[model samples]
Target: MDYGIVSLRSNGMFAFLPLGQRVISKLVALIDEEMRSISAQKLSLPLLTSGHLWKITGRWDTTGQELIKVQDRHNKDYVLSPTHEESVTNLVSEVYPLSHRQLPLRLYQTTSKFRDEMKPRFGLLRCKEFLMKDLYTFDDSEEAAVVTYNEICNAYDRVFQRIGVPYLKVAGDCGNIGGNFSHEYHYQAAIGEDTLLLCNACGISTNSQLVANPDDVSCTKCGNQLTKVTGIEVGHTFLLGTKYSESLDAHYQNEKGKPELLQMGCYGLGVSRIMAAVVEVLSQDEYITWPWILAPFKVCLITPKKGSKEEGAKPWVDHLAEYISCMQGFQNDVIVDDRDKLTIGKRVTEAKKTGYPLIIVVGKRACETVPLFEVIDSRSNKVQVLSHKLLLNYLKEVSIEQ
Candidate 1:
């Protein structure tokens, strides 16, 4: 009964509202599913690390003024990790001691990251406290690193696709983390903060930072100048060969008993940022529509007017609620809006705002006489009348199509 705005920072600390929690939970589950599909094992890392680790990697000096540094009770300097490559590498060195047999180790984690942003804005898009899904891969050779990097890139592609936002892969610059090659996954949106260039003829697309607009070549399709536009970067992967390994002395004993530095690659998906990107890219004038696979709730069931306002609705409301409950019990995702006070129109509007895939409206006429309900598909603007018995099957078929 109480709805209040939640502030992320009272004076400069992390806080969240119920809606924020729901969005984060959905994104984490979506990301974890993608990671598991690729056999990337999930691991948790400490939020704080000794400054010595950054010093060894030389990032302590080069990471600029953004690093959040603190001192322990013993006066030992520590850093709130903006990233976990060094930490993950150190942990692996202590445990796995890389061998060619364990060449491609894919590990990932979803956790809160800290950066002393000079100006954090745009709600969760740019925040001092943010959530990220960072993954690291270890390989025995540069060739192996490239292959694994591509595999992870494909996994990222699938992740965005399943999330229902159309994105393009663009060549990217390897900024602080030195690497040979990198690519960024960007979602095209009018309000995006990054720029992208595309060649319609050659099918080449890249972020403006890493792409050169070729004056020598024109669009092969129409012989027109290729257009350059901006997009929001949602994810990126880099092929890092022995950079972190050499920096951290992460060496492994070869078969001949010789020690060699392990090759490495790092992939990052801004989980929370992608959630905002989804909202920006997928929202329309009426409401937001998420891809069925990534929608927080697969279906929302709403009951129409019944009995008196205070006494609650008719018996069919309970029957329909029970039916949806049973359907969800059979592995379907459904949210029942059983609130008796809210009107049917208001509930439908709220359902659209929440980006549920399917909306089912149940009324006395449809419930008692035909046992059929009206279904609204927000994505395609299609409406259908289907019997209660066929609802689950219909949802399954439409979900697969999505």
Candidate 2:
């Protein structure tokens, strides 16, 4: 199974291979659409920023050694932004300019972020350069911030659910951002790196850093000792309040014309990391079973075991193409594997390895009969033969649910 020029060596830094790029792109589109539905205006921010911005927020010295630093020809210092909190706050302050009318502003960005990692591994999960979707909200008061925070929280939940991943919301430490409340969305997996605490009886869950019992001795639910487990942190939301605003002097004029710090919140979802999490959670044995909504290719048409020129393989190829063309009319992207060299068994194996949701087998009989195809569900070993006319109808029904 050679990928030719598309093959990637097992290196730590180069996280995404050819197939990974397709997976990541689909996930980004899914997440972006969800964010847009909630009125989250997407903005692109710079990958590098001046050292002064970091100094203003005290991150220049305290963010540890992961900060990737550089200098211009004139020796001006710059740092690759790990997160866009300060940059976003500075932009908001400059644009809105202390007007109470502009309060409750929500802005988000999806782009590449950088951090010089001491050790980068596990494909895109812990890469130094990766895609991230970060969001920031500005509010007039703590109450308003809470409201917006909860809305964003629900939005995150919906995003993950739509992508067919079960996520756990757990309390988290405020860390350097200095926030009163922080929650991390963890995808439960055995290979996850972060530990979480949960009370099975009461359905209470929290990250180990923030877990606490009333008596500090037993679980609050069934009076049993809490169990600790490891999970992957896929997303997080924090109530930053005036932390970044005050650090960057982002004050707005209140009703009395007095300068007041704006309350702020930050939410982050690792777009590339989510790709890794998907593989970690969904892959079984030799291949991956991507959720139909997040699969890079919805249908992979394979004409394995090509017939001789006299046997008339052209009709099967044309039939498959025509079917896919009709699907494209409905705005669905389908991949047709028309290579005449590959064997039927090889094509089937490759199609499954690529994690396509639906596989359509085209043969000579398929071109002559009204029911010329068999549909294979990649997740389960289930196959059904149906009429070509019924194929589109069934796909529509399943795709809608997906």
Using TM-score as the measure, the top candidate is 2
Residue-level lDDT tens digits of model 2 in 1-402: 122102324443454555567767777777788788767888898888888899898989999999988899999988888899989988877865568887778899888888887777666677677788999998889999999898899999988888888878887888766545789998888978888888877877777775454226456567767777789889999999898998887888889888889999999999877877876788887687776666767787776455543245456656666666576333445778777687656787788877777887775456563536778888785787777678777877766766
Evaluate model 2: give its TM-score.
Answer: 0.90
Clashing pairs in 2: 98-252, 305-344, 366-372
Tell me the deviation in Å of residue 36 in model 1: 3.3
Q: Give lDDT per model, in order.
A: 0.74, 0.77
Clashes of each: 0, 3
Weakest 10 consecutive residues of candidate 2 by summed lDDT: 1-10
Q: Which candidate is the best by lDDT?
A: 2
RMSD (Cα, Å) for all candidates, in order, is 3.7, 3.1
